[model samples]
Target: MPTILTVPGYQNSGPGHWQSLWEASLGGVKRVEMSSWEHPVKAAWVEALDEAIADCQEPPILVGHSLGCLAIVHWAEGHDREIRGALLAAPSDVERPDALAVLRPFGPIPRLRLAFPAIVAASSDDPFLSPARARILAADWGARFVDLGPCGHLNQASGHGPWPRGEALLSDLR
Candidate 1:
């Protein structure tokens, strides 16, 4: 069975975050611990993900939110890991000046085809990234895109504390 690695964005996924709830519900799900959650450095975050992928005995299926999704994409740009697939949610647009201030040294926008299958899920009204931008990113990475209607970043604040539908989507990959 493939290991499910949950990666959280800026400040990490707290108890209220859906990623935490999903991790609790799923078997063999683990969080890729970052060195610092409050102030995320791209290189450090990518290194942590690399180490986590290396430590896994089985192929990994990544489930990432917010900046975590960006980290996954950054890592995938050059890595050739045994990744079964990826479920990227709510990728914040670090390209914008306001967002870039937080995500210093943002990884290069990946144009290469990812080695594994991937899904990029975004909300229609996500404050971070627009649905069109998410679709474009998915296309650039050669992954499928799913536009979840008005699901604000799909986080606790967005009213998805226990997202059963998101879990069902993940099941399809398995």
Candidate 2:
């Protein structure tokens, strides 16, 4: 079975976040700890991801949220490594004015097609991206798109604690 790698957004997923709950519940799931979560540098995050993928005993299925989703695409673009799949949720638009302010280094979100089977999930009411934009992005990356309606950012404040549905989505990759 493939391992699961939990990749969190800018500030990292807090205790009540679904990613954290999934990690705690699932064995063989690991988090790819970035060098700096507060001040994200794309290259550094990509390198950390590369190292984590390299160290995996089996090719892992990446479970990424927000900026972490962006990082996964960046890593896939440069490396030839084959992962089992990716469950990318609520991807933040780094090109947006607000995100560009904090995520300057991750500008120019990759539009290249991913080498592995992947699914990109987006919420209808996510502050970071509209459902249309998310669908377009998923198309660009040749990934299956899932519309998770009205689930803002799909995070803790969105009342997604434990998020069994999201976990089921991850299981699809396996």
For each candidate, what TM-score against the reference?
A: 0.95, 0.97
Which 10-residue span in candidate 1 carries the lowest summed lDDT? 100-109
- Clashing residue pairs found in predicted model 2: none
lDDT per residue (tens digit) for residues 1-174 in model 1: 888999999989889788998788889999999999988988899999999999999888999998998899889876788898898888888876556577756745566678888888889999888778888888988888888898897888888888877787788777
Tell me, what's the RMSD of every candidate?
Answer: 1.3, 0.9
**CA lDDT of every candidate:** 0.85, 0.92
What's model 2's overall lDDT? 0.92
lDDT score for residue 127 of model 1: 86
Candidate 2: tens digits of C-alpha lDDT, residues 1-174: 888999999999999999998889898889999999998989999999999999998889999999999999999989988799999999999887776577867879999999998999999999998898999999999999999889899999988888877888888999
Return the lDDT, model 2, position 130. 84
lDDT for model 1 comes to: 0.85
lDDT measured at residue 67 in model 2 versus the true structure, 0 to 100: 95
Where is the poorest 10-residue window by lDDT in model 2?
98-107
